[model samples]
Target: MDLNALDDFQLVAAHGGFGRASRASGRSKATLSRRVTELEEALGVRLVERGARSLQLTEAGQQLLARTEGPMYEVADAIAAVREGVATPRGNLRIAAPSLFGQLALGTLVARFRTLYPDVEIEVVADDRRVNLVEEQFDIAIRIDPDPDTALVGRCFARDRLVLAAPPLLAPPSGDLDEVVPVPAVVMPSYREGDIWTLRDRAPRLLPRPVLRLSSLLMVRDAIVAGAGVGLVPQSIIGGQLQRGELVSWGTRGGDVALWVLHTSRRLQSPKVRAFVEFLCDQYPDKAFLASV
Candidate 1:
């Protein structure tokens, strides 16, 4: 009935003393003491026993405390919901990604994400090196690695394949991986596993004649698309190209290279980061989109 007094009594009960409650709530001890007394008088029951050592809640106080917690929490949640709705998912979200992944996939993904949620502006720093996400102040990091950083929590959203691919005009897949490796090819950093091409059933030290060595995977893809060379490329980057007959899978698909969304544990609560992670996962479902695209 008396909400203010009821709140004061709850605070006193929680703190175990009027002086403690007053200090915590920034109210005078006299005010808190008076509020609880008024609450007891209004309820026609004894709410607390003000003693020398501590204030002990009576049976009535205990009952009221039990019933009031739920209502108080509900009120607090309702206020929070409104505030969150007004402010969340509207600020700039900084992302750190590998250069190749950023150019090919993340660019399109971020475009689509912005189209859906216009308020969230994205800033991406593309580099192949693994930067410290927390030190960089990045909201999330898109990484292609076998194992993500141990300090950060990550979600493996997509398992990308390293595929030997070329433009349809160059040469079609004859189901011969050994024959394909000798072909003049373009090579990027990710495709090289300790100086050997990562293709299925591949022989050791087979990649010898890469025609063009580009630093950027995006450039390598362009060269392959232009029929400049046959090369190993990420399935995630070129799936749609393969589907559209722009590029053909020339040789064997390589081992699964996991793509991770890495972030600090503290950043898990960010609304924009959460929304983007879910959005990215939705794009790359369980089944590969290579055939569908």
Candidate 2:
């Protein structure tokens, strides 16, 4: 099978239709359709179910696209590496990050990076769902306390910990350090019945009485500030609120959580990726900014 035909097929599949793919690649719609047809013929299967107003990929097509997208991106990155050896970073830089970090910190970081390296275009997707870097074609991912994965490699740029926070009026009275205070709490959906919060170094244990359950930490913080209940949130996200006395920290919870900027181990360190990692490391040389963000 011709690689060019396969590439064209992937492009059309990626962009959802031949017309958009044509506009994106500066190739005629007829040419893209012909290429996909040729690819389908070579493979002896129908890849696309073409329609007047829509395009849909067959099961085989979906499988093919999913399997090949990562390798194709790797190939492009390899070509780019050789064409621009140790040169100025130029190209699209796709990033995936946790929603809280993305909202609180990533925008500013991306803006600064862009100002320094004007050639690099950035796209950031902020969601809590763990994305497969290779399958998703992401240049980097910023994860908090990521689990061990042999397929990923990167540096832990910062450390953060969870803190119990609440409005001053609603905060549990500080009477006994060893007492398990039963506080009305705004918690994540993961918090279940009888789940007690153990503070770092054996500080007062919090027996959270769930008053409200939120899906995201941002929402939990808002609820806590609104006096709904005390919340356990990452210190990084609530630094400003804590400093401004909008929310008072009850105490730190558990141990430190490391924040990492990671990339696929299989891919070469493209100039764009290297520059971004370096930019992040330079910004947080002592791993303090993230901890306090």
Candidate 3:
């Protein structure tokens, strides 16, 4: 199979059609179409369904693109590095992060990164879904308490602990250490009835009466701030509110959860990836935003 033809086919599929691919690559539409045809002939499979007004990839084309896109970009990066003597952070860097974390922290960090490396382009996808980094072509992923994956390697950038917090007016009065207080609570969808919250070792337990169920932690925090009810929220996210006296922390909940900056476990780390990981570590030098209270 012709590698150049395969590359051209990928370019066309990625850009949706021959004309757009041609415009993006500075190659004529006729040449791109011919290359794709040659690739299909060599592979003995139809890759694209070309139409007058629209273009669609066959199932085979979609599979091939999914399997090869990440490797293709890696190969391109390798070649570019060899040609340039030193690999500088100058290409697109795609990042995947949790929605709340992205909204709370990424804006400032990303802005600082762009100022330092003006040549690199960034795209951040903020979704809570656990993504397959290699298959999805994400350069980096910021995850909280990620499961063990041999295909990935990363460093823990920061650690956070959950705190049962509430507006000062709604917070239950401090009582006996062993007492279980039933408080109206804003809870996550995962919270269940009769579930007792052990905020900390030797600390009083909370029997939360679910007043509101929210889909995201951000929503739960907002509800708690508005005097909805007590809620379990991450200290990193709610620290400012607690310090400003907008909310009162009952106590820490569970063990600390580590925030990691992860990438594919490839032998060679791209300069861009290395730079970003280092920047994250620097930002959280203590590996935690706030101490557990």
Across 1-293, the per-residue lDDT of candidate 1 in tens digits comes to 77778778878888999888888999999999888888878889998888998888888788989999789878778989868855567788999987767766677889889998898999999887878777878888888773645678867777767677888877443434344344677886544533555455544224536678887666888899998888776776787788899998755655577777877774436778778888887887872332221
- Every candidate's lDDT: 0.75, 0.87, 0.87
Better of 1 and 3 by lDDT: 3
By lDDT, rank the candidates, best first. 2, 3, 1
126-169: candidate 3 lDDT, tens digit per residue: 99999988889999999999999988999998888888898998
- What's model 2's TM-score? 0.67
Superposed Cα deviation of residue 15, candidate 3 (Å)? 48
Best by TM-score: 3
Q: Name model 3 segments beyond 4 Å from true.
A: 1-81, 171-179, 290-293
**TM-score for each of the candidates:** 0.61, 0.67, 0.68
Question: Residue 39 of candidate 1: its Cα lDDT?
Answer: 80
Model 3: residue 171 alpha-carbon error in angstroms: 4.7
Of candidate 1, the 10-residue stretch with the lowest lDDT total is 172-181
Better of 2 and 3 by TM-score: 3
Which stretches of candidate 2 lie above 4 Å from their native place?
1-86, 171-179, 266-268, 289-293
Worst 10 residues of 3 by lDDT: 284-293
Clashing pairs in 1: none
Model 3 lDDT on a 0 to 1 scale: 0.87
Please give the distance, in angstroms, between residue 86's alpha carbon in candidate 3 and its true position after superposition: 4.1
